[model samples]
Target: MSPARSDRTRRPVDLRQRSTMAGEASAAEAEVEMALDAPPDPQAAAFFDVDNTVIQGASIFHFARGLHRRKFFTTRDLASAAWKQLLFRVVGSEDPEHVAEARASALAFIKGHTVAEVEALGEEIFDEAMAARVWPGTKALAQLHLDQGQRVWLVTAAPVELASIIARRLGLTGALGTVAEHEDGVYTGRLVGEMLHGPAKAEAVLALATRESLDLSRCTAYSDSINDLPMLSLVGEAVAINPDARLRAHARDAGWRIRDYRTGRKAAWAGVRLGAAAGAVAGAAAVGAALRRKR
Candidate 1:
């Protein structure tokens, strides 16, 4: 053989060395993938409603109170807000007209306001007013789900900023709430979509489950009003917390669990009556004055 051919024949193939390097590269690639993506939790989540479900009263009532204290609007404005809140608490969020009016009012209230400023105010107000009012039973249930390595998400029709503050204070995973549109940092007096209510909540949860690769059959949902029936039915476990009369009846008929944290039905009704009366009185006076001024 020629000298070049002899040299090529003398070169030995290091198969073991080549294999080791290839294996190392594959292992490194897998490590990088593992670092990039987290494994999805096999366990499911628990969704909790705010307002009468987690707390004793409407959350927006507290928020409005805070805004009124800060002079974000006048007492007349507060009266209008109080009237809307009373309707929400008494009649529930089922009326489309009321819903539209509430949406318009909320949009106008936050119009031109900085999102960060509103969120900061919400957090401060929550700590001062809403924190101490959380129902021990509902809160314990939420903690139980957390202890079980399941995620707990607050589902509400409230603003996302307020919902986030509540979830963070309670050490929950996150929240799904109504999205108010904003430009730069200020609210544009518009919503990105429909308010997170009724069927919208179920849709939001379904989307969340799909995104997280969750098994809806293992999830739980809790709510207080009949309007949330769609959301409650979407879950494997449905719990009615401080349910209204309609919801209580529906829960009984559907064989869902019911938790009434109120001391007594009569007392609860009495409290609602008192609040409604106060709001009506203030609202009537404000409307009367406004009409007189117009004339």
Candidate 2:
């Protein structure tokens, strides 16, 4: 099935608009007009964070890798993105600077590309890289919401086109994500507002809720990172799935439902093994340099 067409109206909500109640309300009404064919439950819906919550890794990182393979960017750009992905995996959260850099890089790469072109590539990339990476446990949770007649929307920091593809492929309601500004069907290489992250996520959810006439107290939200606290806090039921250290602690204190799919010992051992491998590679490089110097 083709991805849901939310990106057609996926414009970013300005944070400054929240200063006035009238402005905020108007912005909410204008921002979200998701073309979800699913009949919403009216009172409730579920919002899920994409990275590490619904998927095993960062969706945008995977998408970037796919784009790099498609000759969208250079090897150096991919290396930089890979490093950011590694940091995200190790730390289990996002850094503002890293997010900004990624946003800038993404815009630079897609400048002048038509929205249709990117969306088409996104479909292929999703099948190639994102489909297999979805967490079954989290997928089940999203399915449960669907079974209960609630709309399940993937709220992510990834581009709305990619997020919408994942949502459609997974047979969910729709998605809300970062909006890249485009004009006359081509990318302008600029953002409408800011990336859909941190507090901005909460704002998007609020706007979406207003647009869809959803009750915040009846809604549920799931996420893995502490960066999504604002979003998690906005809902009536907050679930922490494979939560980071900070989010786990906060979830415990707040009495939120915590679901960890990863085996703690196994994950720790994997990290140790990765560190050991890096050390070994460094040692080999050092030995090679010493031998060359002696020669």
Candidate 3:
């Protein structure tokens, strides 16, 4: 037989042997996967995207808004929301760039504050932003994770300390957020961890799954933004809650659950009304001074 003919015959047999081994491995894995996926305990995990998911808008933007109400923030604070709202409005939708700009500018506002002050302000913002707009269904879904003894993690690109404070106030189980480098009491404006959004979010979820011994095949995730698609798809169940349009379309295509939490109710306006009342009193004082000056 020719040398080339012999080589071809040997290659076919080797290929068959490799294919057989691979088929066996795949079959074993299929068995294990079937077992792991077997009616995963009515227990389920729920991941929340922090910004627009749990709160009315971006959390840090709301922080800036509250600061604006306090009338002490720089123009950069308003600039945070300006470009975003304008872009989203003009296009009749949101783009990832606008969302990211809002996040970056909002976190930039953290560069100068002492940790204690940030914590205090974070608490205050939680009272205002979350009090009036926290979706009840979202919290209830969180409770469901707790009842199932599954993990309830707040996933966001905000600073970890800020996210944790918000979680504790909301009675959540855990938090996974952007980690801005910090010294004793002030931010260094550098990130300690990867930005916890988009593909980074999915990586965080996987890391948590491995650390916590979770089965991703039995996990669930919730978010409102299309940016969360990476993490949402990592789970067996992806729930699109109060979702934006892009996410809604993706969820529909994937046959995921899409829920609406917007009751069109912005009730229980907490620190907000307090801020407003304070403003009204100040306005009255300024008007009285103007009248006296005219007289």
Candidate 4:
């Protein structure tokens, strides 16, 4: 077998044995009792979605912005910005395929760069650009759970590489994000794992819970979109933050906690969310105004 494949196959086994075991051992002495205690039939987790559910807007948007600023995307994103405007103007539905394709196109655009460079870029994107973009209340809520000793996790459709950077920065446990397929230290412009969206997010969360020995009944989940219902349905305490109409209605009917952070533009709709405000995140301005002209 090629050395790369042999290495990749062995790395996970090694990582799991070392990393997960170390994490379990380290967290063992601390109060994991939150997952154990509670009334009979305890729910044992607090799941947070990235991209508008935890951060100010779509994590992808900010990451894309960062990449754009660094000269990653082609002229196509701008060209598509126009088409997005027109599509939303006329049809009111941003095609999912287009969304995925755009993401693939973007990832493909940056394929050959080293993971370290991407991580470095991500560091700047999170700290300098998106750090202040968190919503005032969301961070507090997440901290409360962590302080209470409950495990906090970020589950998103973002690429794991990008999501892990943000998760580590925020002191969250880890992220289960969309896996962009990699081949010999390169991106393949396609997903290697499940796209953690909608029902998929719930699936991912549940899987993590099982792996981590977490309890779902005692767990809490926060989100801003109807699309996140897959995640919200699996838990007892679902907090809706700055919810859209459909999710708002669901939150109201289900008696979910609805919190708002946006200051203005409260109407039937305010176009497709370049970002959504949920958890501790607020919308951030796009990245790369400097390189926008180049594209």
- For this target, which candidate reaches the highest lDDT against the unseen true structure? 1
The candidate, 2 or 4, that scores higher on lDDT is 2
Name the lDDT value of residue 28 in candidate 2: 39
Cα RMSD for candidates in order: 20.2, 12.0, 16.2, 10.0
- Per-candidate TM-scores read 0.75, 0.74, 0.65, 0.70
Alpha-carbon deviation at 224 in model 4, angstroms: 0.6
lDDT of each model, Cα atoms only?
0.66, 0.66, 0.57, 0.57
Model 1: CA > 4 A from native? 1-41, 84-96, 273-295
Where does candidate 2 stray beyond 4 Å?
1-40, 81-103, 264-295
Indicate whether candidate 1 or candidate 4 has the larger lDDT: 1
Q: Rank the candidates by TM-score, best first.
A: 1, 2, 4, 3
Per-residue lDDT for 1-295 in model 2, tens only? 3354443233223233321232232233232334446554767999998887887766766665565565555655455444543443334224444444444544554566576876786788789988998889999999998888788888876667777889889988788876767789887767666656666678788877877789999999999878789889999999999876778899999999999887663458456334422221121112112222222
lDDT by residue for model 3 over 219-295, one digit each (tens)? 88998778678789889899988776678889899899888776542453334323322221121112112222222
Stretches of candidate 3 exceeding 4 Å from the true structure: 1-44, 74-76, 80-109, 263-295
lDDT of 4 by residue, 191-236 (tens): 4432444555665666566766667778899887787887888887
Worst 10 residues of 2 by lDDT: 279-288
